[model samples]
Target: MAKLYVIGIGPGRRENMTLRAINALIKSEVIVGYTPYIEYLEELVEGKEIISTGMKGEIERCKLAIESVREGKNTSIVSTGDAGLYGMAGPILELAKDIEVEIVPGVTAAFSAAGELGSPIMHDFCSISLSDLLTPWSLIEKRIENAAAADFVITIYNPRSKGRKKHIEKAVEIMLKYKSPSTPVGIVKNSGRDGQEQIITTLGNIDYKKIDMLCVLIIGNSMTYIENDHMITPRGYDL
Candidate 1:
């Protein structure tokens, strides 16, 4: 039976990827993904049929992967974070026909960024992407407002891009209506990959200029705090 593996590469680092992800890649006769994510596979995808596309080519990649699988080639389509979370898994499953599809989970940016910035996600949390390309900005704003009102620690993805610079600021504005100005916010760039950088700042003090699309921001809830430069959201454990 032809099979398609929807795999998550995990923060663009080989070590961060799950062993199953690696094995899936090895078993695949063809590799498909966004261009940058394909590079992260490095030598693992060597000698395989590589189908890569630039940003916003997600549907194309999914179609190509399905085509490859239908042609009797075991194919692996990769996404940076857990494929299920704002990754390739959703579309692949939605567009796929009868081909066998397996979703291989990997460490998402939130968890990777959280590990680098202490434990800001130790409590209840929700992730929201600031990119309004496919989603409407009004919807994004409403989600941000609800997450803030619910006091859920928020992990923001696609916080900033060349054209979407003001979205993060708008999100912060919505959050400010409910969260305190002193709420801990951890920003991590490049996450578990090379050139990783992280900083624990406050909701009132985010240097928006320092953020980019590669960055993930974890905004702490009311119970969250910064101690010893690490963002910590207590899980209610007794001392």
Candidate 2:
């Protein structure tokens, strides 16, 4: 039987890795992931044959992992966040094509980002991937506008890259159309890792020029507040 392991690496912290995920990693003979995801497991993945590639190479990487599994060697594919939530799970499963694939979930970056900002996502919120590589920007804009109109807190992923800039600012502009300029915005870059940065700003004060691809941006709803230097998005219990 060909067994494929779809694992979640959980942000960038080694300590954040779960016991089940660790066991899965240890048992795998070969590991496939993005370059950064592979580097994160360097110490944990001593001796396994590793295949690392760049961003947007997920389809190619998944193929390598699936082929390795078919050859009777335990093979695993790694993702940065939760396996299923905008992570590697969907791609891996699509490649599985009726094979028995094991899914080991991990914490998503948004949760880690939210924790760094002190539970800003504790209430009802929606997660959005700002990258328009696989999806259309028009669709992305509609969701942002709808999320803003519904007053739902939004967590954005893959905000800005070297080639793709200004998209995040466009998202902010959409939010600003429906949300107040003073609404709290939480920006977390490389959360749960060294060189981590956390900033709390507002729709009117955010500097989009300073943001990078790795940064995760959170735009609050109209009810969102900045309290004692923390960004908050209430669950609407307040009168």
Runs of candidate 2 with Cα error greater than 4 angstroms are: 236-239
Q: Cα RMSD to native, each candidate?
A: 0.8, 1.6
Top lDDT model: 1
lDDT of 1 at 21: 98
lDDT of 2 by residue, 1-239 (tens): 65788998898788888998899998888999999888888677889999888978989998888889878888888998788998788988777786679999998888888888865776678899988888999999999999999988899998898877889888888988889888888889998777899899988899887688778888777777878877777776756
Per-prediction TM-score, please?
0.98, 0.94
The Cα error of candidate 2 at residue 127, in Å, is: 1.1
Against the hidden true structure, what lDDT does model 2 obtain? 0.85
- What does the lDDT read for residue 94 in candidate 1? 91
Off by over 4 Å in 1: none
In TM-score terms, candidate 1 sits at: 0.98
Which ten residues in a row are the worst by lDDT in model 2?
230-239
The residue-level lDDT of candidate 2 at 186 comes to 89
RMSD of 1: 0.8
